[model samples]
Target chain A: MIILNQSKLNPSNIQPSEITSREVFENRRHFLKAAGFGLAAGSALLLSKQSQAAIAPVTFKANSRQKISGFSKTAYGAGEKLTQYEDVTTYNNYYEFGTGKSDPAIQATLFKPRPWTISIEGQVKKAKTISIEDLLKLAPLEERIYRMRCVEAWSMVIPWVGLPLASLVKWAEPTGNAKYIEFISESDPQSMPGVRSPILDWPYTEGLRMDEATNPLTLLAVGLYGEYLPNQNGAPVRLVTPWKYGFKGGKAIVKIRFVEKMPLTTWYKAGPSEYGFYANVNPNVDHPRWTQSSEKPIGAGLFGGRIKTKMFNGYSEQVAHMYTGMDLNRNF
Target chain B: MKKQHIVFVKAAIWLFALLPLARLIWLGVNDNLGANPIEFIEHSTGTWALVFLLITLGMTPIRLLTGQVWQIQLRRVLGLFMFFYACLHIITYVWLDFVFMWDELLIDVAKHPRILVGFAAFLLAIPLAATSNSYMIKRLKTNWKKLHQAVYLIAILAVVHFWMLVKKDLTEPIYYAVVLIVLLGIRVYFKYKPLSKSKVIKAM
Candidate 1:
């Protein structure tokens, strides 16, 4: 039979100095009942004192040297409730694992993200392949709570821990001719089962204009809610372009290439009429089959009500200038 | 059939027909509908609607092939259940999703072809559901058959709505489409073929 962790049940009484034997720990309640004390009192003793500690909200811990700096938590962070880490981790659209929203969480558990390497190549002056361990050391990670908007008209406020993508770009030293940056996700069918389906071209690809790639708001997230990124959320590393639709932030990234021309993104290649290359979160530009005027936050209760969608997902101040004269409807 | 047996069958039909809605309520009350409960509710109701529609359409073919007149008794129940689920699907969209905001809903219905098609299918189901009783069936006679035949068109529209709603996987809608085609094909074959004595007796 499986045993509940005793430490979790009695947080205060259990300590390193007094190591309880496994047999004693497992049979403590039986021993207590055998003794003169009433079972109710014995259970009360165990349950009362540490009840608060037992139910204390879990705080996620970051990796060593992964603590970020210079990120001031904004009003948006305070205004919007953070999506539960459980919900954020479990409900994902990582088609690499499978098409179902819950598929990634179950299927990606066996995925080995450690001993991973990401290649920075193409139009960069100094193209190099770096280990994930070394990649973590490249920049100080920061916690930025940003609104993630899906093209499917759902939204989530996520606390992401990562450094700016511009920092990585600077390290790569991109050539002036580099107009766009293409991101390639890990797509070996042996590792990612969803790749077996021809629903999308395998080895999912996404791209951003050089300026968008180098924008201050663009992040290369390795963690969420102050913890190491969950495998379903693209553990080790993933892209986070807050102003764009969530798909633009390709997960389980294995390659970042600086290109002279705009590369064909996977969604654009799959259905150009539905998914555009720019993919900026604009309320006015509806998807072919659905309206983008409003969104249902994932954890929001049934009929929890929708909030109106904003242009650039309410990051107009930061990203609107990038498309000063361009028509959002046309680009969308 | 014995009167008691018919009553027992009718009760069983009611219980079976109400199971999906009951399960939905249980899930809703227990908070077991997962993260996006609204989506779970919408998808469940919509899918059940399609299932009941398929079952209702299959009743005639099953009765004709098996010479089971009792199968016809369950048709009205299944047809009503389809309409009920379709109503729930629309209510969830209008009340929960759009919050009765007519302006936004109008714009949404105008812009999205899938929504328009789905709404059209639901609209078509309403008259059939209202006229399902013996009174209307007898009152309209042959015209009732003509009106109820709109179900074939509604089935196609429902399938198209499903096809348009999905993002990548076409497996589900394709499966539904195949079932609908086979059901329609059976009807077409029986309609066109010269009836043998055995065939006419079987259909009767």
Candidate 2:
């Protein structure tokens, strides 16, 4: 067993300015230039290498389809560490690609996300099939770091760059009769092999109440981590409802329909007993197979540990009013 | 069977049975168990448990077909491995996954049918594992056969537990189900055939 000399490593002996000065060496160029003429060059190089390894810059492949700019530098929060871009893209549950967590990253490479069109129809005053470019021009995108909680009791903090869903809903000019907005995902069996199997009904569908759809927190994400969304992560565009479970965020959206009644969601239709239409992240309410009280954050290594799940995934302040007076247990 | 052959077979079975546990340790030490290691460990142990259960079930049919009584010795070894893996699976869930939060675990078991079924199957395997030794086998005699027959029921419950655990894509579960059905079918066919033949002979 190894024991540390606690007296020598005491925090009281460390000066605040010394700590701040040490942080200044975080810049590799500064460290290199300062050490260029000194005998401390070797140790400086070693320190720089160590720091560089700790904060290795993530590289995102550029997509020609992505054009939204001026939204990359925005930081949503400093508290929660963002789930690694690699994990965010590679570990996914986009069933259209495949059911395995890693399958989407592999199979979705063949998926054609560009030249995509989303048809806005059903009870909308302006019903049109718009190209992705035209949709991008509709509104300016902003980076929002949101906590995504999956029903499987895993969670991630993703920095998503997107326009608010409310802007798109407003542009559609829904008729007075529209009560719900249904989002449909692309599902060509030739492309999405997972669709061939009856794992879920083809053309995965998800819906939100009109009020929920127009909520400021609801985003139509086009990019993640200052880059175009990876094919595995819904590519060109996808829904991002921070308060609800991840499945509610329909991937690779193909169609948006304004309806007078609640739409049949894929998971809810598959197993209503397990997946309810309103999949709000409620810690008090447990899933049929697992408890929702806690979540293991992905990319947080083997024993990276778990945190207590919050109601509405810690967005209760923003979304709790939407379900006021309604029994969450019953809705769940 | 020759004493040497029995020793060789036992050594091979031991290595084969311990492979999954060894692989898990390697993966854990190498930090290659992926995002959710607890889940990975749980799933790996559970699957091995089911695989061993199926292998144990298959032994009887193979013995019947080949007229090898030595296969019966292998069956006990395989059954013990099945129980061992099942214990690991449960221990992983209780100690690592839930962190010994008994209240939450109890609530989860009560709420989830799959967890309840899996726990029940593990509970049933306890008696069989305990009586696998020669001492208990001789003590119980005919009743031991009846007690160990619960493995068939355990197999069904294990399959259902796996089926319910997955969110979608029943391909893996379906494969397990098919293997189990074939094994059970073979046992049923052999079991009734001798009875029917004896009945015909008695009638004549």
Backbone clashes in model 2, listed as residue pairs: none
Tens digits of per-residue lDDT, candidate 1, A1-332, equal 11223333576534342354554444543444454447565445333422211111112222111212123232335556777555687789998888888899888866767668999999998798987766766665566789999888888889887778998898899988999999999987887788888989878999999999988899998877654677889877899998899999998889999999999999999999999999999888888787898888877788787888998999999889999999888888
Error of 2 at A328 (Å): 1.9
lDDT of 2 by residue, B1-204 (tens): 898999899999999999999999999997677666788899999999999999999887775565556777788999999999999999988877877778777888998899999999999999999999999999999999999899999999999999999887888999999999999997787677867664553454
Stretches of candidate 2 exceeding 4 Å from the true structure: A1-69, A72-75, B194-204
Q: Let me know the DockQ for model 2.
A: 0.55
True contacts kept of each: 0.69, 0.46
What TM-scores do the predictions have? 0.86, 0.84
Docking quality (DockQ) for each candidate: 0.61, 0.55
- What lDDT tens digits, residue by residue, belong to model 2 across residues A105-155? 888767777778999999999899988777776776677889999999889
Clashing pairs in 1: A68-A141
What's model 2's lDDT at A147? 92
